[model samples]
Target: MKVHFILHSFNASCMDHNTLKFCVFLILVGLLVNISFAKNDFENCKRVVKVWADSSLDKEIGEDNHKLRDLLFFLHIPRTGGRTYFQCFLKKLYPGYLECPRSYDKLRFDPRKKKCRLLVTHDDYSMISKLPRQRTSVVTILRDPIDRVFSTYEFSIEVAARFLVHPNLTSVTQMTKRLRSKTKGISTLDIWPWKYLVPWMREDLFARRDARYSRGLNTTESNDSYDMEDFAMPLKEYINHPASGDIVHNGATFQVAGLTNNSYIAEAHEVRHCVQKYKILGKFVLQVAKKRLDDMLYVGLTEDHRESATMFANVVGAQVISQLNAANSSLDIGDKIEQRSFPDSDPHSSEHQNSTSDRGASKVTSSESGETAELNITVGELMNSYEGCISNLRTSYSGRRIASLKRISPVNFSREARLQVSEEVLQEIRSLNDLDIELYEYARAIFYRQHKTTLQTFTEERWNNIPSIVYGITLWKVLPLAITCVFLLFLFLVIVNVRRRTLKIKMKVMKS
Candidate 1:
């Protein structure tokens, strides 16, 4: 009996030890899971904050009306630092107010009836005009027309090369040579102009439905909830037709090539009928169909006085950067740090991968001419540029038109405002010193260059009550750990209960 008792005691001790080991294993697993989740969340949060560091985040800048509603238009110029800005602003201030559409078409269609605080896309003014922008701030960044064209070309070639579409043209120089080549047998697919122009010509720019000629366009049907980064397609397809330009099909679509008697042509167009419309007839014919189609004449922020352009840019940057800094600071992105360093420069190579360097190099340069030609953009410019243009039309752009003057007040954007915006954010942007001094040069270069500019003079009244939009990475990270702990705790309790019950049964058997 003593020997049997000793054996039973040893067995029980061994069982208890095994049970303890199992519980410890569960706990270890739980901790690992939790830590994994927390780390993921932390990274996500940092990503969100980093996005705002880009100057492009101001794409969603707007004001809340007395009705307590948000209204803003999003300008998504891909690879234009727009992603970072939108993500940061949405995460920090806008929260539920903004939507980033993967493709411009789906975003427009889905939100046709829905009023939103912010709507951003690579879409054109025509598509955005359909949105309720009566009280919203409509804004977009324009790159130097030449650089914009260059980027579009480069991006297209990269896509084409990936699919092995163009064999002879592997690099930009080679592609340029191939493009300029007068080969008679060259297929439209083999050349740039043909490939770029085919879709535009094939598609009925005026037709609401997709044309059979353009059947080779973006093969994917519209998806309401597509994410841009995850989207993929053949390189040939992306460049052949951009979805942003697809807004031509929407109700407010601008007919770039329409044959109507009454038409508004973009200032960029050189057609006799078009130039006559703006310069001669002055009828205010709608060319770029947008929310305020009649009002959007390319206006220079200042009367051909060059200094105003620089000041305007700084003000815009200051406003945007200040808000972004506050937003970046509010997030508790648990402990990951961003790798903040400029990329190395590559001078010998034609196409380099350093995003920062590429951005720096693309700043606008003046043509041989000393002054840049003004586009008929802002009404403020119309009033200032041509004598008696605004008074003759008796028209006013919808926004609070900064009065027409050769020189704008530089005093408004104070030094204090610039200091409030983070120097770190400013570090990301290409400095204005590298760009042409003209308004168009600065505007276009700033828009295209990939960098973060600080907004030192942001108005507290605009974003006062808004909570920083945090990336949900922390919740994602900690959730795993929490789940593991809870699961382990539950398992431990169950084990204890089972052991007690088993012991009670054994004792009863022994007594019996």
Candidate 2:
């Protein structure tokens, strides 16, 4: 009986041990299953983490090994933030690889030497024809024509003000009289005075041109002797003058079409084709202008400068840098004048001299301060004029659909002094610059398309990398907890199995 009982107990003990072993094995299997699931989750996470490998920019980077051999020809339009672009971005990006020759004499190109990668110039579209078309990538920035004209006018005014200052000339009236007196040979009384004026002039009766006016004026000589003060009439007189067209004419088209000479005016009377006769060769000119614009790789807008810079950088395969630094570094006329006029002062001063200097310093300081104040006021007026001109352009294009356009305050005049432009003047400006307006609109459309494509590409690239970014973040947060839970569960299963084995052995001993 005792043996049977012991045998029965041992059987029970063995069964219990076997059952505990099975349970432990099952637990281990469960742990393994958990581990497998976690591993699968981690692997799924890895799939997302690897998304950056599919970036379009990555492809671009890979392809960057192939260096571009084409010369970047920048058509630097005046008053179009070209200085900032050239000095700040291009110079830094290309470093010692930029050539900016202001005159035709310095525009020599040597294929073998290839001294410059970038050729920036104020030279017109005609200049591009002179270069190897296959090897040149032409880029240019365009501004609102009216705004550009205003900026040019203001710049001329500022330059003239700095150099043509007279002690007796307290107001603009006195200054105008002085300028007229000095410029005796330069008459402002002609029916079409623009022909006799400098080619760059954009204001007053001087804005109109006649073929006869170009007969004696040499392009080179006129440009060389061009004086801003010579054309500095009172702003009121300029606006009221019948010859001062309602709006500044197609300065951009003229320059871009390579009509820098007076030939455009001279040939105005000769209609080469009957189709072009209605507007006196206007349609032909427009077609030619469009063709020239089409030849450019990119046409930028000053109004959308930031996007323009990005586009420029992308085309050149350069890392985008802020153009603001370069823009800020550009010296204004005021800064230039200040630098030239204010040389470093002497360090030495005698005690007696100092006493006298102190006595006179207040009077000198007051007088100088008053003069500075007046000059600043004039500059402010010029800036106001610039703003007013821009406003006028905006209003003209706003599609208000009114019979008569409301007149804005006159430029280069005080707020109290109001000037109104006739509808005839406004219509005339629109007619003259119709081609330029069309070109500007076309350029805007192109810019919008290019900008949209670039943005879409960038967005797609970012989305491509997002899965990897999320996976990495998930791994960082969830990995450690998963590992610890697995270890603790494994330890618990081992302990439970050992305890059951010991308890089964004790049961066997008690039975014996």
Candidate 3:
């Protein structure tokens, strides 16, 4: 009522007020709106003080304390230190046989058939529907959306540039069927949404660099030899491009809510389907995202690698790692650790297996500065380039190891440098990722609140001795002797007590 009255009064006063008075009135209205939004923002996310208060326990395979049996789903947002978390921590904490095959290009995960305990994937929140009815807890890591966007742009450019330089950039085909394959191989450049954005970036960047050369920037440089990292388009151009809609705009919110502008999933249309999937979450996206965040067991931040890792070890690790001892007792856990550090690994894959069928089928023709050239992309070249892109991505990304997260390190392994953007571009990025910004802030606050009362951070001693202390593992050679000695000592003490009791009874009888 108060706001209504104030607004009505402003409406009336606006007709008679001078310019100065009108400006003051507008300022007052702005303050009112800001205050209301501030309150709503606070109300959206509950201030969580306890971390494990909501962690549910379950009985699975005769194990009552196995809370992780309730589906340890890791909602891995791209470029969010996810590789480090999975490679360094999750693999160490759980056996490989327990991890679900990754569902990247495809979205089919059946826990009932697979009987997998851990789920780590890049699928969106829509994955909840595809999953069968079961108890699951979602955990994820968030980044400052601005930094995430820049990293994404940087990584895309890096991948595209490599594709441009590769010998198989245009000439490779006859790819074998990999239906059940976990390697998410992208076979074409005309895929929906943001997949094509990579090729678009490639073309734009080539044009951008060629223009520089024409202006006599580096005429002395070789025609064929060049740095692979030099073709990244300018920050403003990359973010503002028409192709960046789905991939760049409020990605965190979209991933969290699993929302698409459809009454149903994958609805087809003549024209709408052809248009790229628009990814900026609409009104109430944050509300849905915040509720989803609140429902999660934990939401980690990319920036707070140490604190996040420690909190996860203390909170989530106790649920899963506490049960690994029985599985790895005779087996060396160090040997059971992650053998495959990266996701794009497949030994059975062959490059030249079907080259005869696709010798000159799929080729890309690109022209720059009125010079034309046709480059063929065979299946071998495409797979090889994709694999190299993965390698380059690995070089660019570095996450803290679980064992080393507790300690500080001086060496920096990340090839991705801190990017600088113009003020206008920064503001534009902020505008585009506003929802993610708010969501990240709420997650950060909850993280601190959850850890505010905990005293000890996860230590290396605990990491090394997890099986022994938590999983009840004993030394293989000494366990039997220790058990026998305990039994013998108990037997001897029982005999001595019985003898003393008999002696007491006889003495009492003689005295009587």
TM-score of each: 0.28, 0.44, 0.53
Encode model 2's per-residue lDDT on 326-396: one tens digit a residue: 32247465643442243211112211010111211111111332211111122223233334444554464
Q: Candidates' lDDT values, in order? A: 0.33, 0.45, 0.52
Q: How do the candidates rank by lDDT, highest first?
A: 3, 2, 1
lDDT of 2 at 31: 62
Q: Worst 10-residue stretch by lDDT in candidate 1?
A: 404-413
Q: Candidate 3: where are CA atoms >4 Å away?
A: 1-69, 104-107, 110-112, 167-169, 172-196, 209-230, 260-283, 323-420, 453-512
lDDT of 3: 0.52
Per-residue lDDT for 1-512 in model 3, tens only?
A: 65666666666667666566775776698678868965664443222201111221111112222245456778777778775556545544543345555432223464443445567766666676555425566788999898888767755555455443323323311121333245434432322223566667666656655665577653323221112223345566667775566566677766776543321234212112122222221334566577677667778888987677766765676555444444334434343343222222222222101011221222322222322122233323433443444454455432312122111112111323332235677798888777789988988887787677443343555577877765575578578988999999999999999999999999999999
Q: Write the per-residue lDDT of candidate 1 for residues 1-512, one digit (tens) a residue.
A: 43345445555755777676655555565566667765675555444333322221233233432121234554433333333333322222232212322222222334432433455544444343355545544444333332333234333333332322222223434765664474322232332222443333222221211232245433334231111111222222332344422221111122211211212223222232332322221112222222122122121222222332333333332333344344335533321111111112222221111112222111112223232111212323322322232232224311112231101111112224334433442332222111112323434333323122223223453365345433434788878999999999999999999999999999999999
Say which candidate scores most in lDDT: 3
Model 1 / residue 453 / CA error / Å: 15
Candidate 3 to truth, TM: 0.53
Candidate with more favorable, higher lDDT: 1 or 3:
3
| Candidate 1 lDDT score at position 435 | 18
Sort by TM-score, top down from the best: 3, 2, 1
Question: Which candidate leads in TM-score?
Answer: 3
- Report each candidate's C-alpha RMSD, comma-separated, in the order given: 36.6, 38.3, 18.0
